[model samples]
Target chain A: MRELLRVSAPVDLGAIDPRSTPGLPEATAGEHRKGWAREQVALLGAGLGRRQEMLYATAKAAQERPGPADRPAGRVLLVLQAMDCGGKDGTIKRVAGAMNPLGLHIRSFGPPTPEELRHDFLWRVRRALPPPGYVGIFNRSHYEDVLVARVASLVPEAVWRARYDEINDFERELTDAGVTLVKVLLHISYAEQGARLLERLDDPRKHWKYNPSDIDARARWDDYQAAYAEALSRCATDAAPWFVVPADRKWYRDWAVAHLLKETFDTLALGYPAANFDLGRERERLRAGEAGAGGTGEMNGR
Target chain B: MRELLRVSAPVDLGAIDPRSTPGLPEATAGEHRKGWAREQVALLGAGLGRRQEMLYATAKAAQERPGPADRPAGRVLLVLQAMDCGGKDGTIKRVAGAMNPLGLHIRSFGPPTPEELRHDFLWRVRRALPPPGYVGIFNRSHYEDVLVARVASLVPEAVWRARYDEINDFERELTDAGVTLVKVLLHISYAEQGARLLERLDDPRKHWKYNPSDIDARARWDDYQAAYAEALSRCATDAAPWFVVPADRKWYRDWAVAHLLKETFDTLALGYPAANFDLGRERERLRAGEAGAGGTGEMNGR
Candidate 1:
């Protein structure tokens, strides 16, 4: 699934169908297909949860043992990008939501604050990176510097264009520092987005999510698509690949992203860290209610 | 359940049985009780999820519409504190884990960093407070200043004693600013903790969570209990009350917290914010794919 969705070469955004379920089993009934996708997502989510726990445990052990300070442990950053009314929020609620919140760090990037704008665009991104041994999710991440900045003329053409290479280089540094990147673009059709927008307008409950400026972006949908194509093509790398998941069908998008996360974690080959202390003696001491054991005050303070 | 567990009057911690299931239904089989409690937690969780969405939506609407700056929207903070192996982590996984991660902010407070120590104890806590419309969780929180600080004699007696009043003032301030506090202490017996520690030592996968200093805290259980009783009694108020949830049973603990949250949100009387724009015009414009409609760029740039 990763290989199929991955942008290994220059890709034409227009060639891909936003409604395609490339790897999903064919079913005559749409409801059956949706149910199958939902089940797949749940199955994949259970695996993802286990992997995330192992990753967190490994980092905690490293912290307790105090190894070389410079050496970094493995971590993950799942970056989600999409157009207005796309399924970024829904995808997060379904996929990342399945993992334990203790080991999950979620940051939703909005327009830059005055403090953020004063520094380089990547500065805030750097600050939000996951610490060692956790999964950090960015719902609409630094990709906006290239995508939105380019489409809306938020920055100069040269500036936004230069960010593609800058992003690639920055991601490479993160990979070297033990941060695995799962970058995905929730690909939804223009017509689907219009329908979603109309639905939101039609539901009083969804009014909080609706904004007038969404139509402006929809009007310039072609420009945004061109921007996304260039960004995905230029920034796709061996270390930090970009996956374009068909997102018009929310269930398929959820399942695909969960699958991507599970597969990516499997590649890490994570396992529970071996106990550093004497197990037999610790067990005896714990059973006897012994005080002042061999460990530090760090965990005790909890 | 709220009234049953709330610390309204001076209370006796020792009189409460750690294994007691206060509001849980009676069942002949232990597994049956566990199953019933688990189902109840899930049912309450579903309602909690909807209320949380409403809270988040209300806040988002206020932000977009630019309401009075001083009047804060409703938000919730769930503070969990317990002895070693008392099930704080398990409770969070089963309860807050059921809510959407997008509107959840979870901060686990370990021992103070040097920077944290340099400021008032509540300084780091204030920094970690949930923003409006979000549910913020503190796995271990500012109450540590009283519990650990008093038990370990980390500060002068006068200083730690004065903090009770200070904490009440701070909590009052938070409540005045629209932050509802659901403070809970997961009550567990000393023997149960010993058993849990030994179990951790027995399992390789659980070793990462075990620390030698845990026994030290366990040995000082009486002092910690006194500290907790005083803190709970002194801080209990109409604005921000404390609940002593019997937590030896993990299922009951999860259900009680979820129930507490659901009831608290019910008191808030949260509902979907009324649409600030003309519903008819917005629906027609969205249908026509109109550009530059009535709202701002905040929701755009997604």
Candidate 2:
């Protein structure tokens, strides 16, 4: 993980001020650190399991409360980029797998629809944002405008360069609206990505998930990384920071994302609103034919 | 709602022993009874909003936690009859929309996929059953084999007649293995359904959601209802009872379903699991490292 980060954000690593974390020790490199990271991850996985069950229970409880503002409206958005078969699908399936349906939504951004192309680049993405009290997961988000478009030169350099500021401002607005934007760029080594792409070609059911154009994109890895670094440095804000996840290790990536999302939601302090109801009174009115007595003769079509 | 139920589940209503529910005092006419039912429905909606939010939250939390005995590990099966605007798409979006990405899945039962055409009728539906801890929302599930297939004479009488028992046994096995099966017969009146069909024709974006064949199907509403009534009567069990929801009003339908799902999850008894490492021990370890190791990692890939 540190190696990937070093390559992706070398400057930021040197410049950022230091702070302290409880569970994690200093970022180190060695066999011992690897072993320790594995053990901690296993323990974290167990906590994740328990946490998931509780989430389901809590969602069930929250349903009994009233609508709109009665529940916490905050959401988490996960953004990723990868070569074909770089574990993007697997990560989303596993990490976001157990979330409650009522509170979580996943949108896989494909080529823009006709409506999206007519407007500015960010319009379609904004439409996909989760409402308050929900979590929105974007498979490949607005970053595509920069990463894919830049690597392929689909848009001219000037057009793509201007997008860095537009993208950053878009993210800043979302964060200010209470969306905890945690961007993860899945950094799969080119070798691992190639092997997976070959695996996709070999499988019939998965063949549809692959596109030949992705191979052309993979050829320009170094160039894309430079584009990525430029965008991350400019866009990483206090509210939304980019995490370059090492996708060569699937287990590690899943663990890190689940851990990160759990931390974010924990900070929100979401729960059911205070309960207050008098069912008996409502029942009495029903028996006496008091409620709905004089409103309307019957339910109109409206 | 009761009138819709009276139509959807003719025998279920008649079998409801009057001794169970306290009947309202004598009214001037059945008009008053209709008024009373409307009021009861209003109250039910109020209670359902909070319940929906909590269910969503619980599912989100569950996504982070490790698998539990009760978490969905079994396959999900969907069954539905063929009808245009029969609440299939809306139901699919609403239910699947709220679930975690990991355990929540959906399979729309379109005309059989090429692979399905080679097998028996039930083969396709059986394959789509959700794995455990996963929620599967079937848009027009297997019931179509017995309902529309019977009503439209799409298959031989013998073929369709035998399917009812086959479906019942299939559901029994799924429930035995911890699969929570939900069956909803969205009962829309002929008048109400006509308005919906007309609206679909009027809306351009919704054009893709409409099918011209629906007009011919609507012409046979009574035949479809009779098929539904018979199939539900034989198949509805204690473990999985058909929810005869009034579909004329979309809000009420959403409310009823959200309520039903809440009741199901609440029955699961999902709660916080026992902690592995002592909280105090973990906290101590965290606080111990707070001074030496806590720092923001490098902001990497775009």
Candidate 3:
């Protein structure tokens, strides 16, 4: 049996330098691997753009043939987390925005309800898990209990520490159950965040989305950064590693997210199930006053 | 001022004939008009499919490009009514499924929350309207308090009767604010509804969607039909005419909805705004340690 204790650990936030990270191996690890990482990112970016165009085309085709069982099954789940102005909504609008509705599902989880707060943190999250052949996304997920709550002193340090392990276990369970989780942490600098917040306040229409409390949150920016570093360090398991994306530039953010989502879906091995419709057999069955009496298996054909 | 007392007599449920009557026009309307209606239906079917494809594409493109002002500022609102098996969800998925997330917002209202119940019915609805450059879809919206509640004797007769005028005025407000409302009623046969309900019961995964209370409502199906006819007849205004779609066949349902959505978006004439980039000016600005921002205006140069 797999050892659960060994799998979970508290994330070490303070020690990680964004410059020196797991993505680029140490000098002793060899230049080949480093070159490979860069190549992978480049190749993933190209495949993602191609897949995006194909996805739009496929959705258009599906519109013509409204209900077809032959649609590609299996989907991608993209998880995004960020500080107040982190581009979660913008990310969704671009990457998965054009996905075929039948194949892709985007779910946003705000603050949990009273009933949800009573259960284990993961309960509400598990309920939103996509069914087979669908992609489900969580905007700000169970991670909030550990990251934001801990940083803001909303929860005790011990309570937040205990959750890193819980998150690891939960993610492992999802991966084992055929769900690919791409966790993205949009890392915008304090200066960039200030510009974004000002933009929101400056615009009258966006006033609805701004909260006065966000200012208080901004004051504790360093604490949140420390929390993110810790959570990412601990939870970046082999199964679902976190990507610290530099998000100062909106163009780069789009490119990075598109790369991440494209990579996740490309690995899902989704395709139409293999089956044959024997027209002759269908015609013969129809002739015997059994036109609509095809077995339940026929239902699955669609 | 519009005449408030000019309401047509309510449709008599007992007089409904599936073979004729409301399914087709009265004899007084003439054969040439009938032929025209048939041709429009066919053209609408084909045009709808094409338009649905374009809507998704346009929305996706808009979402990808970030405006300098950060607001494209346009929207489409699609509304429908309530019934256990009402085709709202299906219609939304089929018609507006692949729309760009940036340009699409779908709001589904349940029995109102305490906050919503306190206000007029349109309060919750208007709050849920899409921002500029987006499409807002309402699944079983504000009309419920009027249509179903009126038919089921759930509300006072006077209160429900007043709603017809209220809805027309409310839709006019949306249209004036640059929001286009496309309303559709999926007219299904009693037998078809029975088949769908049975399918839901037989499928374990769909069991949550099955409510025992639906059977009680289905039993009073004729009353619901009469309520729908009465509601549609009154509120089908020139600004936003109600389309009574023959929805026994899902294929035709998709076709009709696609046509309606396509026509609306096509009318908007949306495309990329002009590229106001001055390469020479930008070159000077770059050398002067400043980037001259692209001011917002008629970006029609594209």
Candidate 4:
């Protein structure tokens, strides 16, 4: 499934079919695949809870280790990128939403604040990075500098093109600091995206989710696609690879994400910290109470 | 119940009975007080969940308010202090633990690092404060500068004495900025703490919780009680009044904390962010999704 879905090398995204559902259940004749895909997502969700708990515990105990350091405890960051209404928010709700908030953080990148713009593009991103022993989900992440900025001519061609190497180096630095990078590009066809954008306009409850900029970008779809293809090809490395997901079916998008997360956790090889206190002396003292206490404070009495 | 627990003005440390369960149910002769208190805690927990959710939503919408600014959205910070085995950790697990992690963060303070020691005592504390819309729980807080620094002779009498006004002014700044501060000192009896420390030795799983410094602090029970009495007296104000929680029994402690939180939320006058988007345009857009929606990329000059 991973081999079929992952883009280890550069490929023309235009050749990929967005509506085609592969690496998931085969569509039976006259069958509702949403129900089946939803069931799979549920099953994956159940397993995710237990695995996430262990991962959190492992992360907490990593600093005070009396345990194996084979796979050092740290953070896993999942970066999500796609066209507007590409189900980044939906993916967050269905998959990342199941996570423990204590260790799971979602950072949605919007336009840069004045303070953020005062520094390099990565400055705000650096601040939002998850602390050790947690997972961070980035919705419409740092890639926008290349994707939107290049397509709209917000920056010159040379500058946006040069960001590919910078992003790769930045990711490698994170990997060096015990971080796992899961970069995903939710691939949707041109026609499917137009439908999703129009659907947003029609649903009043979802008006908050709609942005006017979406249509302007949609007007330059080919440029954005080319930018994404270039970014995915250049930035996807041995340490951090890109997953090009077929996202016309929201359920399949969620299921594949959960599957990828499960695979990531499995590789972490997490375990609970070992207990490191004397059992016998502790028992004897418990029964004795303060009769066996008062050694230190007495020495430095007020 | 709140009047009984809160310290609106200066109060005596020695006069207050730690064993007295005045604000909670009395464990009368053959009375199932534990079961009753547990039931009450559960009820409060359920209400806490709902109120907290509203607070979170209200906070998120505060910045985009077409709503009243009279009760603007903000953050809540709970500062917990007590001698060893006074149940700061237990209080966090049972109380703040119930709130959504999306907006609830707990910071456990230990000895200052070299960099921290170089800054003002409030520097690190200010940094760990909950971001707007969050509930930040401090297991041990900056009040330690006055309490431990005074009782242990770590600083001159004048240095610790001067910190009282500093803390008051700092808290006043936070209150002005819309943060609600709930400061609590979990007051446990000397004998009860000795018993808890001893019991920790008996349980293997609890060994990780037992620190050697706990016993040292326990020996200075009288001194710490005096330090706490003074700190509470000097710092308690309208914006951030101090609550002395009787922590002999863990259930009662958790219940009182939750009760106080419910009171805080009730006073917040929190309302959901009002719907302010264009409903008519949204409905029209939704209807259009099934109609004219498939022209881009090829239609564009791309």
Candidate 5:
């Protein structure tokens, strides 16, 4: 599944069918497909939880040990990118929902503040990276500098054009520092997006998520698609490849992302850290109920 | 159930049985009790998730409106304090596990770093408060100044003694500023602590969580209990009340915390924010597929 979705060659966004489920078993009924995908997501989520615990445990052990600060313990960063109403938020709610919040760090990037805009584009991205033992997710990320900036003319052509190598170098540096990157682009068709926007408008419950500006962005769909194609082709690298998931079907999109994460964790082969102290002595102390053995009289006067 | 667990009057730690299932249905078989409690926790968790979404939606709506910066929208902070092996981590995993990670912010405070120690005890706590519309959780919280510091003499008695009022004043400020606080103490018996510690030593999988210092802390269980009783009594307030959930039974503890959170959210009576835009116009535009309506020609030159 990872290989099927991964971008090794140039990306042509128009060629990929947003409604197709490529690797999953075909179903005659929509309900069957949705149910199967949901079950798969849940099963994969449980595995991801166990693996994340191991990753967190390993990092904790490394912190306690006397060693170089740059010791390579596994950390993961899942980067999600999509257009307005592209299910980025929904994907996070479902995929990250399965993992323990203790081992997850999620950051959503909106329009930059004045302070963030003053720094280099990568400055905020660097700050939001996961520490050595957790999975950090970017709901939208540095890729926006190239995508939105390019399509909206927020930066000059030359400036946005130069970010591809800059992004590749940045991702390579992260991979070298023990951060596994899973970059996903939720691929939803223009017609599907219109339907989703209409649904949001019709349902008062979803009003908080609807924005007037979304229609403005939708009007330039072809321009954004071209920008995405360029970004996907140029930024996809060996160390940090891109996976474009057909995201019109919500269940299939979620299952695909969870599957990608599970595959990444499996490659790390993480496990519980061994006990560093004397196991036999600790067992004896616990059995003896040694109330006075380590008494330091710290609380005695009180 | 909320009234049963809430700390309103002077707390007597000795009067509460750690093994008691106060308001839940009693079952002759342990498995039956566990199953029932699990189902209730799930049901309560689902309700909590919906209410949280409404809280988040309300905050988002408020942000878009022109209003005072301090305009009230619901925010929640769940502070959990427990002795070693009292199920603080497990409770968070089961209870917070049921909510969308998008609406949750969890921070676990370990021993203070030198920089943290330099600041007033509440400095870090202030920084960790949930922003408007989110539910923030503290695995261990500011009450530690009165619990661990008081019991271990980490600070002079005069200093730790003064923190009770300081904490109350700070909590009052949070509530006044529109943050709701749910303070919980996972109450486990001394014998249960010993059993849990022994289990950690017995299972290699649990070894990473074990620390030799835990036994040292266990040695002074009674002193710690006295300290907890004092903290609970002094810090309990109407705005930010304390709930002592008997935590020896993991299932009941999770359910109780979920129930408490559900009740707190219910009190807020949160509903989705109404559409602030021209809903009818937006619906017409979406239905019309008005591709050129908002075209700015930003992407045309490229």
Candidate 6:
């Protein structure tokens, strides 16, 4: 799954089909593919919960290492980017939601507010990173600096173009700070987006979601695709690589993301922090309340 | 449900039991109460999706309301507060998660960062309110000013005490700005909290969640209860109402919050905006590519 999904080099928008369902039984029909993906997600869900807890435990251990630490405790940030109707929210619910919310932090970046725009693109993002022992999910992230800014001309050609290396450097610094960064781009075809946009228009319950300007944006579909391909190629790195998850099928997208996260957590080889104090004594003290606090600490020299 | 849960009058914390399950079927066994709460939530989940659409639609209509609007478009902000081990995250996943993520914004406030502490307590919170069309969920909110600061004496006695009416006035200003403010206090008993804190210590998977300082805070339980009582008495208001949700039972807590959110959204009488353009012509234009664009201007004078 990692090799299938990971964009190891710059992306060529024309070569990779959005309809590709990597790592799946290709011969299966659409229904069976979805069913198989859902089944895999169910299995992944259980493993993910355990792995996430371990990752959390790894961070806790680092914090309590009882000395100045050279390395940061483990924390993961999953940065997600997608087109207007791409399934960022669904992926969050289906994949990340399976983890314990106690250790999850989700931040969705919207069009910049007046204050956010006054600062550099990465400023607000810097504030949203998950603390140690947590998984931070970015619904859309700093990639917007290059992707949307380039496609929509939100910034000048020179300005948005300059952000690629800046992004790479920023991500390197994050990894150096003890953050694991997994960037995913939910890849969907122009047809798929148009179909989803039409659904929003057709369904009254969905009308609020449709921005007529999206149609204007859709008119510039090739431009955005070109922008995404450029960003994917320029910014993906060893420390914070990008994956183009096939998102035409929602379940496939969810499965691919879950797989990526599980792989990432597995690489961390997370484990619980060992008890630093006498467990039996603490248990006894807790059961007996304050009167027993000093009674059980003789051997530990408390 | 509103009368039962809403703090229409100044709250008497002692009078409201943390175990109380208001508006629920009476005389149910523990298992049945849990099962029943789950059942109602499943039903409310469907209603909630529709109501939230109406809310989003209401915002769209206001933006296109054919006049200079005196008020901002409508939105909802739910500010949540609770003690350690309270189920704020669980409530978010159960209630707000059911809404369309397109229109939901959630911000979890941790201990103030140094920059945040330099500002007044409400400064950061004011920045997190949902934009005109969204439902903003604060996992912990400014009530921390009155609750934790008061209990822990992090600030001077006079400082935290004066924040009560300041908070009320702040909320009133928000309502006047067209945001429906729903403040919830997830009220749980000290015994329940102790049990939860112990579970954090006993379970390796939960160890990271247990803070030693929380034990010191737990030692000041009565003090927090007093603080919560005073804040509730002072801050509950008609423009921005407070609901003391009984949170000893996770299922009941989830159900009550979902219920409150559904009621709030329904009261807005939300509806989709009238098609600002000729829908028939717009569909034709979308289907024919750009050839039919200018023809969509008959009835709505677009």
Task: Tell me chain A's TM-score in each of the predictions.
Answer: 0.93, 0.72, 0.71, 0.88, 0.93, 0.90
Off by over 4 Å in 6: A25-30, A39-67, A96-134, A148-162, A274-285, A288-302, B8-10, B26-30, B53-67, B97-103, B109-114, B275-278, B290-302
Candidate 4 runs further than 4 Å off: A1-5, A10-73, A82-101, A104-108, A185-230, A244-259, A275-289, A292-302, B1-5, B11-73, B82-100, B186-210, B244-259, B275-277, B281-292, B295-302
Give the per-residue Cα lDDT of candidate 5 at A222.
83
Model 5 chain B: lowest-lDDT 10 consecutive positions:
B293-302
Q: What is the lDDT of residue B34 in candidate 2?
A: 47
TM-score for every candidate vs. truth?
A: 0.94, 0.47, 0.50, 0.75, 0.94, 0.83
Which digits, one per residue and each the tens of the lDDT, describe model 6 over residues B1-302?
A: 66688885556776777777887777765667788888788689777766766777777667766477766788889888888888887787677655555567778887898999999999999988888888888989999988888877799998998898899899989999999988899988766776787787798767766666676776676677778778887887878878989898899899999988888877887777665655566565556643333333221111
Per-residue error for A288 in candidate 6, Å, reads 4.7
**Poorest 10 consecutive residues by lDDT, candidate 2 chain A:** A13-22
What tens-digit string does per-residue lDDT give for candidate 3 at B1-302? 01211123443323332223232334535546545544545465445433433444444445445566333445677776635665766766546544444345677777787888788878998888866555677777777877667777866899889989998999888787667777766666665555666665555434434555566676566577768778878887878766655565565455556656666767777553332333344334332321112233211110
Reference-based lDDT, each prediction: 0.86, 0.57, 0.59, 0.74, 0.87, 0.78
Clashes of each: 0, 63, 8, 3, 0, 1
Candidate number achieving the greatest lDDT relative to the actual structure:
5
Worst 10 residues of 4 chain A by lDDT: A293-302
By the TM-score metric, which is better: model 5 or model 6? 5
- Which parts of model 5 have CA positions greater than 4 angstroms off? A26-31, A68-71, A290-302, B26-31, B68-71, B290-302
Task: Give the C-alpha miss distance for residue A180 in model 1, angstroms.
Answer: 0.3
Model 5, B13-84: lDDT tens per residue? 778888888878655346687888898888888888899999999999998895875458889999999999
| Model 3 chain B weakest lDDT span, ten residues long | B293-302
Interface RMSD of 1: 7.0
**Among all windows of ten consecutive residues in candidate 2 chain B, which has the lowest summed lDDT?**
B14-23
Tell me how far the alpha carbon of residue B201 in candidate 5 is from the true structure, in angstroms, after superposition: 1.1
DockQ of 4: 0.21
DockQ of 3: 0.08
Each candidate's fnat: 0.61, 0.09, 0.11, 0.13, 0.58, 0.09
TM-score of chain A of 5: 0.93
- DockQ of all models, two decimals each: 0.44, 0.06, 0.08, 0.21, 0.42, 0.16
lDDT tens digits, residue span A8-93, model 5: 55788777888888788765356687888898888898999999999999999888885875558889999999989899999998
